[model samples]
Target: MNRKTLVLPAVIGLLAPVLAACGGTDGGSDGGGAIAVGTTDRFIATADAPAPLDPAYAYDVGSWNILRQTVQTLMIQPRGEGEPVPEAAESCTFTDTGNERYVCKLREGLKFADGNPVTAKDVKYSIDRALAIKADSGVSALLSTIDTVEAQGEREVVFHLKTADATFPYKLSTPVAGIVNPADYDKGKLRDGFEVSGSGPYKLEAKVENDEMVSAVFTKNADYKGALTVNNDKAEIRSFKDADAMDAALQNGDIDVMSRTLTPEQIKKLSIDPGENVELIDMPGLEIRYLAFNTDAPGVKDKAVRQAMAQVVNRSELVSKVYGSQAEPLYSLVPATITGHSNSFFNEYGDPSTDKAESLLAKADVTTPVKLTLHYTTDHYGAATKQEFEVLQKQLNASGLFDVTIKGTPWDSFVPAQRKGSYEVWGMGWFPDFPDADNYLAPFLDDDNFLKSPYANSVIRNTLIPASRREPDRGSAATSLTEIQDIVAEDVPVLPLWQGKQYVAARDDITGTAYVLNSSSTLQLWELGRGVSG
Candidate 1:
């Protein structure tokens, strides 16, 4: 869809006043012989609490989820679609022939939860702060296309780009573009602590951090002016040591909802006998799990070794046996739902065959019995990760072509270690920042990538990606995407494993279970509420 034509110039002028005066409705019943609806605390999960709650420093999924609820962006992705619509802004347009200059007009009378007025300057300052900090895992890379951000008067903000990018609007819809109050934050430094000041649907009431476990309580923001209506007055998000503890809490009625990091077996059991207390809600598969090979490492440096591992690894078995129907085999770095995705790995290697793998190794003059180490995180992805790695170890060693050793670590250390090239081969998962093919290709294939592996292909990095981004019609970028995937399959820097199906298990009384999960796989906390039947 072409988002450039989504909003018209005249409609923006007409809607500015109406949107500013539109405040949230009174949430679920307050009590006094009525259902204790708004007063109920809705509990959810995060693998861990995001270290610094500053929008500029928060990049992980856990942090982004929290920020998405507490912060407001210029544009937002509505339920069931990837196209961004006006959120805080009344309207946004390109305003230039080259698609390099983007202009957004803020709605009238916008105010933070603290009752401070939100102006164009706060929006510009928030983005400028993110670029200034440039944290290792920060959102600076996503905003690298912007050359300048200027606030023209109170309501209008303009962005000048270094190059033409059709997908620039999608980037602004992410948490990276969350507008913060400039008076509460310094432009040069990241704001410390978990307390936040935002104008989204909810405001942070309190944050309590106890060792590795952390919890945050949110209440409906009276000053929030946006499309979303807060259904519940208060919500709680807690991080557990593992999925087991989180699931147990859900079963005992201590927590109202549970999502992410549930094992396949746990999901199956919950689905079979969910009881009258809870219900399991299944979401579309928009996430991918993969194995990344450190190309600079010793045994993994050879192309033949990487290719052999790709050939012999049984994805079908991995999905069927380990993940059950919760996931499906993925043959490309890009998931099937996205445009330009192809089964390049499957077409090149076919079904798992030991003979083909051995032949490929022999053709490259590599000696038999190649020894390799594979690393994975125990507490990061889920409880199933350990079993998944064991299954992989068994599959590779059974072929007699290689000897694999398995190592496990916690998420706290795994991320930094992997980025430092500490593992020869490792497991990783990706949840898209935005629902675009570029999100899949650019982050992993670029010269300076998130993986921090020594992989540089000038053609794919310099030519194909740039050409693809310049296309106004995303579908027309298919050819470049196909070429990029083909190059990835041949090189095998990272092997595609499977695409996951999102599951959110919540009490049956929750009214908006299905509506909470958006197309980008983010939870819209405002959509959740305890029904009157409860």
Candidate 2:
């Protein structure tokens, strides 16, 4: 859930002008010939290339992107929008009035890339294995409501939940629920390496590893029988050190497509550079960047201290100065694009108030020049992150009420360190598992969540969430979402910073930029192709 995923930009008001000004074009081949797509050459060992392409263990965006291409889930968010449709399953539905039981009927003649039959047993094994391994970064928490998964005959899979959960189907759409061949993977532990056995549009042909980097080659899976259409026979994905390098590769024809991590300035440059022959696809802004406070850390243990910290920070300034127009101020844990989202923080604290912050600190008996350490990942959250934190440091220290020390570590070390409570306050970014407000709430606030900080709220976790899940009508859960937002604003365990716009730059010859992005902001590799005309 904390992974930094890629996205395709949509033709929207914010980006329409940019696209028009740039003489925006589509990606397609000239007539009929093969096309080669390239990704970043720089990959992080932990975040990008941690091995075993097992859906149960793949957590980061890089891993998920590969899994999305190769694995077949019972349901999927096709083109990344709406409720998930049947992928491996011919049909899926909730059977009982309480909504506790769910069932799926497998599609006929389904087979893996290896030409092995895909049965209901494989579906049961996949879910069971994910729960059993329980990797720290895995999506087991999303399935916590499931009590049992059983296969009925060869084509049917049934799930019995401990409680009613209307959002259960959405979980099935994520890569965590991807079906794997039981014969090729272990049921009790993570699969050993990068080798993957799946039933999707593409199959992994080979992988090349470099220093701190990995590149994968995927060919069309002849046995693929899913909703996705394979436009190209093959694709090559590589990791890059940063967006600039990725952009350079794309401009130089070293790569055919570029997604994720492009700075606002880079995007602006691309927008006006007609000679680049790159099409910029704009997508909705659903990604959120936030600051998480370790409640156990000194100088932040007091609730008043946390609230004061929130009051002093200016989200608008962060967006304008650091993020430019690529992001917007986010005042709640849930972004405005999602249903049930509320600007609770804005209502509670209003604009940046030095007087109010000082008053709150006085009430907590906090002395001026309160010393604190702020931590962030140097490489993970993009190049702007360092500048963003520096801006925050200056803003917090400007009041003469705080002594802030900025600390940064690479993502590999940063994730574990933050989870272990090694940082007092830190920055984190989230790409949704699904396009729902519940995703924003559950992952950060659930019991023993990814935050790994000593913080808990019974009403939000034990009460509001379960109540919301039981509500058959998702819109009716607005009351619970509003209450949860209000509670989070009051507690200020995590400060909502900003939400980002998605951008994907593809060569003019690439045809499917429009279809590459789904609602979840995940790029569909199969949708990309070179037009024969190019």
Q: Please name the candidate that would achieve the greatest lDDT relative to the true structure.
A: 2
Task: Work out the TM-score per prediction.
Answer: 0.89, 0.92
User: Candidate 2, overall lDDT?
Assistant: 0.79
lDDT of 1 by residue, 54-116 (tens): 777666666676788899999887655546778899999998888899999999988998999
Residue 247 Cα positional deviation in candidate 1, in Å, after optimal superposition = 2.5
RMSD of 1: 6.9
Write one digit per residue (lDDT tens) for candidate 2, span 1-534: 111222443434334323321211443332433344444323444543354467876666666778888899998875535666788888999999999999999999899988999999999999999988877763688888889999999999999999989898889988889999888888887775677898988888555554343677778889988766677777777667778778778878787778767777777776666244666766776789999998888879888888988899999998899878789999999999788899999999999988899999998899888899899888766788899999999999997788998998887778778767788899988888887788899888887576775789988988999888888787899999899999999999899999987777777767877656566667677777777323
Worst 10 residues of 1 by lDDT: 1-10
Question: Residue 386 lDDT in model 1?
Answer: 88
lDDT of each: 0.77, 0.79
